[model samples]
Target: MSLIHCPECGNEVSTEAVACPNCGRPLAAPAPTIQRRVIVAEPRDDGFPKWVIAPIAILGIVVIFLLIAITRNNEDEANRTVNVNLATQRRTAEPRDAARDTSPPNRIDVPSSSTTVNPPAPPPSAPAPSYPSSTTTVPPSSAQTVPVDRASVVIDAKIATGAGAIQSVKNEKFYLLDKDLDAILADADLEPIEGNSLADSFGLAVLYPDRYGDFRRDALAAISKHIKYNATTGGDGRAAIKNVEPDSYYLFGITKAKNAFAVWSAPVSITAGENKLNLQPARLNEIAN
Candidate 1:
């Protein structure tokens, strides 16, 4: 029986009163009681606290990363070692048997390494050299290299006089031409004098003044500016040609006379030694103007 305030009038109602007596109003119904509830958590079987899960998960991830890095580093080191071995093999001068070459030197070999590899005991030791034939049996000039790069030439030239007299040509230049003398003098318009003999025509042609200056100029121009060798005759008409290589060449010279000229074209093969040539007025020797 709880006391309550009246709704219609300001009055205190007693324990068993159904209505308020002072205000003649019925009392309001009693208010229901509000109950408080207490809730309890369920127990966990795992002993670890919940706050430690984040740090444990983070530490596990770091350990996994470290293991992965270590594995990758080991793999990279192995790969580098393999690559270095391959580079070493490539730099080798010759292909070697890998198993045989890598073995330790002290390893046992059948039949002994020296017995199989060494040349048959060279008759204990020869009284002579082991080569037996080379050191003592040497040839005299077999190995000496004699240079044949140059040779020499000597020539005697003469022009026929009118009265069947042969005299020495003076101040005449004789050229050693590699090309054919016929080819060189082809462009020159030199008309040979008609006679029974080349010596007779040559003697008769020298009576007049010089008429062969143009032919001489044309012949010199055809042989080019490079002359291998040339020599001028003294008063005796003898010239010595030096430093000529050992080859076939033509000894070409033009002797000027009053009205005619004589040409010497001798195809001579030069050797390592001295060579001599004579240029007298002849039909077979001239073979041309």
Candidate 2:
């Protein structure tokens, strides 16, 4: 038999005994002991807890929302400021535009109630004095008398060759001089007939047989006054010097073909009126070689 110690009282007891004999204490069968396995959990290095992460994420989201709201507020404020400035500018410009539209260009503005009174103009000056009407008789201007009978001379020239053949002298230059041809030829200081300025003082007229037979009265007047006179003769080899003053004149001619020249003199008397002289034809001879 196995003995066992009781827990409640210090007494030995049989293994099958239900009670202690000395203590007379009823002993309950020991309750079946329950054995449980103990498991040891290891510490882990995981980050924040799920609950902490959620809070932090929510807080970040709130902060981002706040930043976005602040940015929107700033943009709205800028927009409002710009709108206000534009409105102010528009309001300021409107009056100026209205004034420009209403005002007339290049005009002076006078006040409405003002009266413009111009002073009365002074009385017109006394009437001009009336003087006696005088009749003025203007005397007629004197008429200048032109001479009806002016002096004129006609000349004809011919060429006489040694062969005794006679031909009308053509393209010969002729001249009328106030002095004798001998006097002119004797003067050593006298220039040649061609382009001679002194010739105008001595010579009355020059005649070119090839060109103009008719001479103007003005030209004749010029010659009479010792002024320069140029003339040309017609193809008929006839020339007429008209409207010459009363004087002595010498007729002379020069021929280019034979280098021949000749002179003839006649005392011409021109009265106050008309006179005509028919000169005899002269023959021109070639010069000796």
Candidate 3:
């Protein structure tokens, strides 16, 4: 314990005393002050971290797996469909392949050493070529080139309309018909209407319009065989036909004027490349009767 002298009594006293005891003066030292601080927590912007992440992650994985499985299933179905189609096509083609395989197998002869064989001599000269006449008929071929070696012809013909005498036979139809073909219309089959032979443009197209479609279709089918080729003239009396074979054919057509209808029937011989036949059917120009 430390001692300090009291000011009033000049007596000795302990430093811890609030007052001097010797002089009867009270002396208590002030107790030391202590301060405490309390910390306050603020609410967070995001919700509490109580949500389980593992379950959500597992659910997402399951959904992804299901989507993958569905995609694989769709792919499998498409592949199966394609495979089925390919199998069907193969089945369809097998018959065609079998039909085409009809030729007999090649014969391989083994000559014995004891036997002697001789090769036949080739012919001295080939036979002369026989060309198709007007009556000669050719079977239609699978390919176009063999039927007609791209032969073509263009014919422009006018009609005598009296005073003017020569007028363009407007909008006429021409057919290079294989007259020899059995499919061709015979002369007896041509019916006359209003003085116009069914062969005339007005008679065929205007009088019996319903038959025109069938006639046109039939004419085209005879390319190189029956109705070899056909064409339609514009305002001018001109028609271009590509049915030129190196054979003979019949140039047949129908044209018209104001009061007169004309039918053109003439035998034409087409040479190799290009051939044009001038039609002058003045006798048949008698007014459509």
Candidate 4:
């Protein structure tokens, strides 16, 4: 059972006794078993101060947001530092990449500090040498010296000549047969034969003038077997003789015989009025026979 105190006067009261027995004031009927509560102050319906509560909540939210922003900023700063480091490393390695492409001799050393960037000077290029590209002409194979038993002569018969028969002869296909017109005419004390066929092959005849007397006539007449000379035309009655030296007259016949013919050979020099010739043994036999 619960006990209750009297409300009017200082007294003890049972939860079942509502009135005070001592006071007997009116002895209100025994109060009910339920105790009545006393009302001292009325309850108010007002809330906490708006200004203080709003600022505190706002401050808490701001503190959480600032922590997140600081964490993100730190992360971004770390990434930027890494990127910068990587770029610096790439820049430092650029020279090594170029050196690998170049030759070993052309490679240059790098400085120890990577922060100091520099471009190296280019290497010198090798010089090119100049050379000849033109060709030299070689001499003919047959332009060498060789022993000869006979002489060869080319007669251009288009010109004129006066002799027994101007003919060209071959000395074993080696040397050319030639004579000296000045010397021959001077020794004989005769004028140079006009229209002489020294180079003519045909259409003209050569005659020995009587300037050297019978000795010259005999010397020429003793020869025979005269062949006609021609450059490209066929041989006619005329023959071409070559003038090699002025002191010599080439003989065309073996002996002085009428209607006898002989190929012309190189002339030899002789004293004035001299009739003998220093001829090859084969030629001498041919002339004598």
Winner by lDDT: 1
lDDT of 4: 0.33
Model 2 clash pairs?
A: 149-273, 149-274, 212-232
Candidate 3 at residue 278, lDDT? 56
User: Model 2, residue 275: displacement in angstroms?
Assistant: 5.6
List of clashing residue pairs for candidate 3 = 18-27, 18-28, 19-26, 19-27, 195-288, 195-289
- Each prediction's TM-score against the native? 0.38, 0.31, 0.35, 0.20
> Residue-wise lDDT of candidate 2 within 1-289, one digit each (tens)?
8888877788899878988888878877768889999999989868867779888989999999999999999999999999999999889867755654454322111111111122112225422222221132222111222233333444455544556565554544445666544344335344333233322212212222211112212333433443222133445454545555645445544333432333334333433322333334434323232
Candidates 1 and 3 compared by TM-score, better number: 1
Candidate 1 per-residue lDDT, tens place, 45-153, comes to 7887899999999999999999999999999999999999999967662343343244332211111001111111233433321111111211112112223345556
- Once fitted onto the true fold, the runs of candidate 4 whose alpha carbons sit more than 4 angstroms away are 1-38, 41-53, 103-289
Query: What ranges in model 1 sit over 4 Å off?
Result: 1-149, 185-217, 281-289
Candidate ranking under lDDT, highest first, comes to 1, 3, 2, 4
Q: Which 10-residue window in model 3 sums to the lowest lDDT?
A: 110-119
Query: If both were scored by TM-score, which would come out higher, candidate 1 or candidate 2?
Result: 1
Which candidate number has the best TM-score?
Answer: 1
Q: RMSD of each candidate? A: 28.9, 42.6, 22.9, 41.6
Clashes of each: 3, 3, 6, 43
Could you tell me the C-alpha RMSD of candidate 3 in Å? Answer: 22.9
Q: Candidate 4 lDDT, tens digit per residue, 214-237?
A: 533433332212222212212321
lDDT (CA) for every model shown? Answer: 0.53, 0.44, 0.52, 0.33
Selected candidate, larger lDDT, 1 vs 4: 1
